[model samples]
Target chain A: MLPIATIVFREFLEIALIISLVMAATQGLQGRIKIIMLGLGIGFLGAAIIAFFTDTLAASVEGTGQDIFNAGVLFVAVGFLSWTVIWMKHHAKHLSQRIHKVGSEIVAGETSIWVLVTIVALASLREGAEIVLFTYGMMASGQVTWSDVFTGASLGAVGGTVVGVLLYLGLLRAARRHLFAVTSWLLVLLTAGMAAHGASYLIAAGVLPDLVPQMWNTSHLISGESLMGEILGVLIGYTPHPSGMEVLFYVTVVVLIALLMYRPWHSKAVVAQK
Target chain B: MRFSFPMLSLSLLLGMMTLAPMAGAEEPTYTLEIKDHTFSPETLTVPADTPWTLIIKNHDKTPEEFESTELSREKIIPGGGQVRIKMGALKTGTYPFMGEFNPDKAKGQVIVK
Candidate 1:
């Protein structure tokens, strides 16, 4: 794949996966699509603003401004996404029982669709700003023509949307009976992955310690920047090489959410009743 | 007794925060200049196997991403400003990087020897 296409495609795919997960999870909910679209609109606008002053933004925070801002976006998304899972458990038919089976009480999904909206916006903003910054960079360098960047970006966006469509359809059809199961689990993994990636950017910025620099190098096998690696990177935050802190963030997110949802003591009560 | 998860995790956080990077072990900081959409000293040589800091000063009034896949690092430097990029130790080789905003003019490389 050409570098331009690969770069654009990778970023587009990251946002696509997040959007698709939310779409599938909130399936059958009223007006969720409109909310998500509104989110995309706001996110794109925010991205344009950010892109316009990327230089100013990057120069802030003792020169780690972009990293700090991006990290904040990631963390906010993490918080809201976790809330989504808990909210769904209380609001959805299957999730309530599922939570009960695990000895946890569901919160009223009354948390407003705005939580999901914020997540969608933040996720879209991160990638959208990246696209703007990258394209502008290439444009200024004059190494690539404007048409080239535009075409590459269009193709990449389409490609990402195609995969997203497939995911949503597959969930709606093949997994109709288990939509709750699949989507809820997918949300958990996706959230954890986001946490891990956020930690990595912080590590790169020297804001976080590198407990262990390289857990292993799979770059020789499948580089993280490769197309497959990029897809996996989006779907599960997979990396060819991960630092110790990234692993810690990933595992902690997964375990923490699981424990919150599982409520072991309540499960024991459920088991006794059964 | 069941461990109070909140208390335990809080303690862990405090412990790690205490072990922050020491004031010493400072590496040499290198400088790169971006003027009129171009980088000065297009070829910078640094010692191999030594981590260093790069303070990129952009003289132009436009933003550029200081990106190098080879060095596995990418950061943006705004116009008429500066940004610091910390590159880990490198093996002896030439790693090319460029201004993502002005790829045509802002070209440069880090020569590790």
Candidate 2:
């Protein structure tokens, strides 16, 4: 078996390299020192907080506590995801507009390098934190090994780096611009699944007792402990036998997000300024 | 100026009167003990509607930290020493806790039974 420590180190190195590439692409060589430092600082801080919390939670809920923790985490994850989707729906367009505006300024100014650096730093920090948190959750779930996580993370970094480079070269600028939407939707899908899984955990704990708890049992199709199951679990929070709460959580999250998307409340502060 | 001075004095008096009850308020106490990598007496049964002062004693030689997810509370207790926890009325159910710094030999439970 591979050492978990080695795998984590490799993952960190991969992320660092990806950030470096993004820096090279967006900021060039003129003036990116401060922005680069800020990005690194944010990324590391986010990772450390996530790691510490995950470890603490894992240790606390070792035995039967595990089930409780899983359910609790699942519920909270669902709530958080619902909030995120609604928030994004309302603000993402505005955010992109602001970025384009800022991009124009950077392109026009002599201190353009500094602007580019800050943009790159902010973007990387946001995405980096998400990647790290999601990876940690995957690791804690026992659906995959440290090696699997490292592998996924490394691949993601490679993919993200290539996109960053192409973006800088102007070969795939449109695709880069499309990233925010794509990643946001991806996160929504991922969170919905996590919420369902969490409800399943709670169901097992009797906290959420349900009639006809087995919503079309799929263990015969894909056991929860199998590799395919793990993949499904990570991507869409798939469970073999979901209880009523699981279904309820998943459907609720979807509905709430859909509503928010229909009539989002854009920040009044921004609109008021306009 | 004279009117303003009297108003300020009256307000100060009212503020002191309001804080008198708070000044005499007591901190909640909780009792937690660690043994065998598990928190002995895992269910820390406390009053459902009242604040608690947790006094945790780590009898084991391993360093341990007591953490609860539902409560979102954590306090590190040095081996052979003790730590204190203060909590308000928490929702009914089992709140899980564990030794974070060392998970091996210092394990136990805290049941709010």
Candidate 3:
């Protein structure tokens, strides 16, 4: 039970951290917390359905369905998160300037909160489905009873959520006025890293090129599969040995988004209007 | 800008057609069977530092996800279905895999030595 708890906790931890981070980053939006919660509910439902259809889906595309499907999900998430970063870029100063007004609020661009919904949904779907599947497997094997599985899963879920809350509190403590700006920058990089990750899966499936395969091997120093590596991967896209193509994708996302956010033309004109 | 660069990279990949196709080169194969939610031969030993193919045959009535975080490989094996999984060359080590739907009993390891 404890072992299962540990494994399940790690899985839940990643999702929790991502959820809290995104939620915190979009702090000024009204009722986004509720929307995010709704997304989780929908995501879990989606996860179960997807898990049940794993067989049919896996058989597709010459047995590359799983990879392709996962890559698709990651890519969609990248799109959603990238949209948030860009939307936030147009409103950062507005949000900071209006931070002091507790009751009066001004959300620039008035972009749909659905972007956050989609991200939370994607994040929850993959991990939630995995946890359900893993727990089900353990129960079916009778190696552990249902009671043990339930106990472990509950503990792990709580432990992971607690960590997320802690991280959120830490970020919240960092000067309310600047928190939005700081985390939005983090969101942009995180989104880019996710794009690289999605492409890596496509490369593994032979649908995309690995290019230089291993740009460098740092697995000996910090294996991405390790617990810490997994956390960093979620937080900052830290893969010890990213392929050349992933590096290309990462760099491209950063450069492109940065340009879009600060096109001298766009910035100068917008500042003049302000 | 995002659209342009991805398109540009797509062209770059397509231009390197020769290198891309080589990824599917023939490799050694090993077979594993899952019955009653348990894997046979609980451990499989293979030569290290060589790409290999895994032919998994699932004989149950429900589908199973064959997943391995260590090898970063995953594929679905439908009930009474067979699928091939390819892994990249690796350093000597043990990489465990399992039926994601029946992990507790369906676990197995690839011993690369």
lDDT of 2 by residue, A168-214 (tens): 34523544656545444544565677667555543333334344434
TM-score: the better of candidates 1 and 2: 1
Model 1, residue B64: what's the lDDT? 66
> Model 3 chain B — which ten-residue stretch has the worst lDDT?
B1-10
Model 3, A128-200: lDDT tens digits are 7677666655565566888898899899989988988888888889747688777877777788888888777
> How many clashes in each structure?
10, 28, 0
How many clashes would you count in candidate 3? Answer: 0
- Output the number of the DockQ-best candidate: 1
Q: Return the DockQ of model 1.
A: 0.26
Residue pairs in collision within model 1: A103-A267, A137-B100, A137-B101, A138-B100, A140-B101, A140-B102, A141-B101, A141-B102, A141-B103, A141-B104
Candidates in descending lDDT order: 3, 1, 2
* lDDT tens readout by residue for model 3, B24-43: 55778888888998888789
| Candidate 3: regions farther than 4 A off | A96-111, A144-146, A174-178, B1-29, B34-52, B59-70, B74-83, B89-113
- Give the CA lDDT, 0 to 100, for residue A212 in model 2: 45
- Top of the candidates by TM-score: 3
For each candidate, report its DockQ versus the true two-chain complex: 0.26, 0.03, 0.24
What tens digits encode model 1's per-residue C-alpha lDDT throughout A1-274?
A: 2556766777778888888987798665556667779888889889989988887777765666676667667766787777777566545775444555644232224345677678788888978887887776567756589789878888898888888878778778978889887898888888888888777666656667657656766767877656787667777777876778888999998888787666675877855765
Please tell me the TM-score of chain B in candidate 1 relative to the true structure's chain B.
0.78
- Write down the TM-score of every candidate: 0.76, 0.40, 0.81
Candidate 3 — which pairs collide? none
All candidates' lDDT scores? 0.73, 0.47, 0.73
